[model samples]
Target: MNEKKSVTRLDSTYMDQYDAHVERQGRKKKRLLRRLALFALLTLIVTSSLAIYHVQQRMVYAEKKEEYEQLQEEMGSLKESEENLREEIELLNEEEYVLEIARSNYFFSKEGEIIFKLPNEEPSY
Candidate 1:
């Protein structure tokens, strides 16, 4: 076992006042640190939520943009089909076009007209 010397302290009004002041300062420092920590946590939570919201909005915007492009392409194709159908309707309204289709498909003949079926053969080159 080791022996240690004990020291004696003087009791005075100045020492007591200084100790009280030191204790008050320590408490003030602790309160300041706690406030700073709480503020930092609040800032982190707000920033994280904002970042997540920003990312989700960007994804929704991208999907909408892609859908709009697809719809535009489909609209173009539909417009082309409508134009083709209109042209076909005009053709079918003509008497000559109707007669030609009947002559070709239904073996129809005008006066002194002959119909022949020829073999479709490829020549070996």
Candidate 2:
């Protein structure tokens, strides 16, 4: 009877140690789970922030592209105007073209030519 009681006591002590070990393991598992949840949340936040930043960058690039196209169109118009002005300058440098312009715009004639004068009508007011 004495030996049986000693064996029973020893079994109970071992069972208590086993239970403590299981509790420690459970606490460790809970801690690991909490760390994993925190890591996942942080990852989600970083990914979302990066996504938003990329979207904004794309929007800025699109606006700049539109502005560049507008500037290119204005440059084309300015180039055409510059070419027209250059041609006019070349024409004006020639004496014949200058004389033609003067004759047409000012009605100029060679020396000793007849001049016609037209009478103007009186104003009503």
Candidate 3:
């Protein structure tokens, strides 16, 4: 009877140790799951922020592209005007074209030509 009682006590101690080990493993598993959830939440926030930043950058780029196109069109118009002015300058270098310009712009006349005077219109103000 004494030896049987000793064996029973030893079995109970072993069972208690096994139960403690299983409880410790359960706690560790819970901690791991919590850490994984936190990591997933942080990753989601970072990805969303980066996506918003990229979208804002694209909007800014689109506005700048539109401005660049408008500026290019304005430059093209100015270049055409410059080309027209250059041709006019070349034409004005000729004596006949210069004389015509002077006559039209300055109302110049030959020495023997008669000048006509017109009455000015009254101001409304």
All candidates: CA RMSD (Å): 4.1, 7.3, 7.2
Q: State TM-scores per candidate.
A: 0.74, 0.75, 0.75
Per residue, candidate 2 scores C-alpha lDDT tens digits across 25-65 of 99999999999999999999999999999999999999999
TM-score, cand. 2 vs. native: 0.75
Model 1 residue runs over 4 Å out of place are: 1-18, 123-125
In candidate 1, residue 22 scores what lDDT?
Answer: 100
The collision pairs in model 3 are none
Count of clashing pairs, candidate 1: 0
Q: Per TM-score, what order, best first?
A: 3, 2, 1
lDDT of 3: 0.91
